[model samples]
Target: MPIMFGRTIKRPPWRQCKVGSRDDLQVGQALNNKVMELQEQDFNFTIDTAFTKEIRVERLPKGFKMPTIEQYGGTIDPEAHLESFKFVMLFRGASRRHHVPSIPLYLEGLAKSTEWFECLKPRSVSSFVQLGRAFIANFMSSRVDRKIMANLLAIRQRSNETLRAFLTRLNSEALKVWDLDPIVKFQALRSGIRDVELKKSMIMDEPADMHNLFSRCEKHINLVEVLAAKQEKEREPEKKN
Candidate 1:
């Protein structure tokens, strides 16, 4: 049994090449292994047309699929449009899409959705990056920040809207409005909350500050929206009958 026992051994290629220098053998071995790995990965090696004898490095696979505009609607609302644009860019980043082709694809998607983004039309753009810059200039207006700040300062809960809807819109705009005074912002937000019972309860409690007020209010508002949604869903079946 001891005589039959054996150990497998591994060896590097040493005798195949002239090995003029000690490092040459190691370098050649590394290159050969790397080429084998690339072939296993299905990387393509092509002959350089300009230099008939020269072999080009293996090319990487193109994995990105261009998204359709129908998947995400047009830029009818600037805020909603910005959200969609960000989502698309994030999707591209995750897919490892090259920016050169991606920009045109983005423009094409936008054009397919609506003619409103005329500046980003594919015909108008010669450079892919320039189209992106022009897109920002046109759709994502710089004045939007100022407008949001103004709206945050002046917003009031509309008569027809639910407490949840009003607060949701307020919070969304408030996030974009930079550098607002906390006290002033809180006051504005509270004034817009139209739930009279909730307001009366807050007044009775007299919470120390806005943070406390928000914590108390958000819970109540969420409950109200949930109940309302449930009731609406229940009514839908009765209406069908």
Candidate 2:
């Protein structure tokens, strides 16, 4: 029975002999290392993609001229200065120069005598808009000083000035104080007129606002000038005949 059992215990289906060294066991580990390395490379690639998306690469235009506020007729109007600068930027893009270095170029446009230039001298600016606002505030303050605004409000039509010339002087001074209330502005302009007929018409029937008043006054002044010119022409013909 023992012998039969021993015979029945067939030789193990296969002989157990080691075919590889300890280094061979490391093969699986090396494969795992390779997989981790690939994962790391993918992670780095993803980071680079995200970084590139976040940063904008602006190329500067060739031979671009920087715009200055003074170049646009020395305006104290912040809106005018900023708008003109924006127009330049728009033109540059239209000319195929979309991305340009802006900080240095914007600084170049600011007046050296301006407080904005002095205030920003030691600072690093990242945005042109922010710098522009500062410049606007500084320039506007200079234009709208209390004394200047007061002078504008106190302006009277000079005795020797024609209606057109007086209006021009008044408008030039008023433009410097851009923040006055509309009603106040209209009253100031109305008070300065020397023409009794116009003043009576204004008092009897006030216009809707300053714009309406200005339009009516302008038309009246133009009509007066036209009549005067016609009279002069008629007199010349009569004299010649």
**Top-scoring candidate (TM-score):** 2
Q: After superposition, how far is residue 186 of candidate 1 from its true place, in Å?
A: 3.9
TM-score result, candidate 1:
0.37
In the range 143-215, model 2's lDDT, one tens digit per residue, is 4343355676688888888888987887777766657667766777788889898888899999987788988
Which residue runs of candidate 1 sit more than 4 Å off their true CA positions?
Answer: 1-62, 65-83, 91-97, 107-130, 136-146, 157-187, 191-215, 218-241
- Give the distance in Å from residue 74's predicted Cα in candidate 2 to where it truly belongs: 11
Candidate 1 C-alpha lDDT tens digits along 1-241 = 1232476544445544455776676877888998766544422232111111111222224675555543322344444444565576566553222332343344434544333333232223333244345545555643254444567768988989877787778777777665666766776776677788887786677668877877887788788878989999999999999
What lDDT does candidate 1 reach at residue 194?
79
lDDT of 2 at 91: 69
Residue pairs in candidate 2 whose N, alpha carbon or C atoms collide under 3 angstroms:
59-99
Instruction: Report the Cα lDDT for residue 219, model 2.
Output: 86
Task: List candidate 2 segments past 4 Å from native.
Answer: 1-101, 109-148, 226-241
